[model samples]
Target chain A: TQLLEQSPQFLSIQEGENLTVYCNSSSVFSSLQWYRQEPGEGPVLLVTVVTGGEVKKLKRLTFQFGDARKDSSLHITAAQPGDTGLYLCATVPFNKFYFGSGTKLNVKP
Target chain B: DAGITQSPRHKVTETGTPVTLRCHQTENHRYMYWYRQDPGHGLRLIHYSYGVKDTDKGEVSDGYSVSRSKTEDFLLTLESATSSQTSVYFCAISETGGSYEQYFGPGTRLTVT
Candidate 1:
């Protein structure tokens, strides 16, 4: 079974602060996906990194897939209160999906 | 923000009771998925359906059952609610072309007391 472990289970920072979350795994994945979810809502996809060492940016958020395809990261620049939520990482395995433990981030204004 | 909608946004049920969660989608996507979220577990897939009448077990499939009678509807049922089953459930749909992007529903918060 493939499992993804996320670092800094909880993070609280003030507005305009920069933060980064890491997702690590022991097994290689064909692809990895990042998602952000608010309270009482399902997660929304942020980005999908397929190739090793691929980097994708979304506005103030940056995502990178490890060159080994076994880890990934999400970095936020100048995070605002609106960025507060639970960020999740998922790996697809032969039609089955596995998710990381998740990082709960709270950006206080 | 996907075209997915789950019924019974909030539910409170006693132990040993049977409860079914409904997921309806308007996108007509071929792949429908059910997931449960807890504090540290993130989102664990409970079950999924690739097409009408086709379903598969996910990471957390115990105490849960799913059915898809049509392409746009996927239902999750808990035969006997347990305290461990108290969590938020989400439904998602992925488009064709083997894309990794999936749209999800708002989610249903189910409490077992």
Candidate 2:
């Protein structure tokens, strides 16, 4: 079983459209992080939400941590072609970092 | 920007052969990790090191072994390569165990035939 579950395994939308990806789990975590991975490169940290119900905004991207700390969401406003990549949510439980299957986003021009 | 690099960005090895991938970091972070990314599996941990000569097994460490003789270098060795082991391996570093942001290396793509 996957420690984290992400929804909409793949998403393709036209530029300027808005979309949201989700990450959920049955267990509570101290914190959760969101990363974006481009082709042929490693994933890069986008934002980290430590407290429950915390929301962070990074430019056109917004991340929200669930009140129960078992889920999180990433919403993109006015998506652009440059936002095309794999979106992964991660957390550290039991001293090990676990990642979700990831949501592959394709923002078409 | 993480000052981390993986050796032999890409490698192809035959079955039953031993293969070692090296991860070198200039950040001198205390914790280092090795993870393998597959099609449906985002990134599964293989092994991790907390300090020099201090290491522990990850979720998927059955066929892999890690050595961290120094703080700046961590090595992952596959005893006998298997076709199932073909995946892209990534190295990440963090200052602390959890809650801290991790910096990742470019990654090494290994193909076992």
Q: Please report how far candidate 2 places residue B86 from its true position, in Å.
A: 0.4
Top candidate, metric DockQ: 2
> What total of clashing residue pairs does each candidate reach?
0, 0
Q: Where in model 2 is the C-alpha error above 4 Å?
A: none
The lowest-lDDT stretch of 10 consecutive residues in candidate 2 chain A is: A89-98
B1-113 in candidate 2: lDDT tens per residue?
88999998999999999999999999989999999999999999999999999999899999999999999999999999999999999999998898698999999999999
Q: After best superposition, candidate 2 residue B79: deviation in angstroms? A: 0.8
Error in Å for residue A39 of model 2: 0.3
CAPRI-style class, candidate 1: medium
* Per-model DockQ against the true two-chain complex: 0.67, 0.87
The local distance difference test score of each candidate is 0.90, 0.96
- For candidate 1, lDDT tens digit of each residue in B1-113? 56788998999999999999999999989999999988767888899999999998988899999999999999999999999999989888997524378888988999999
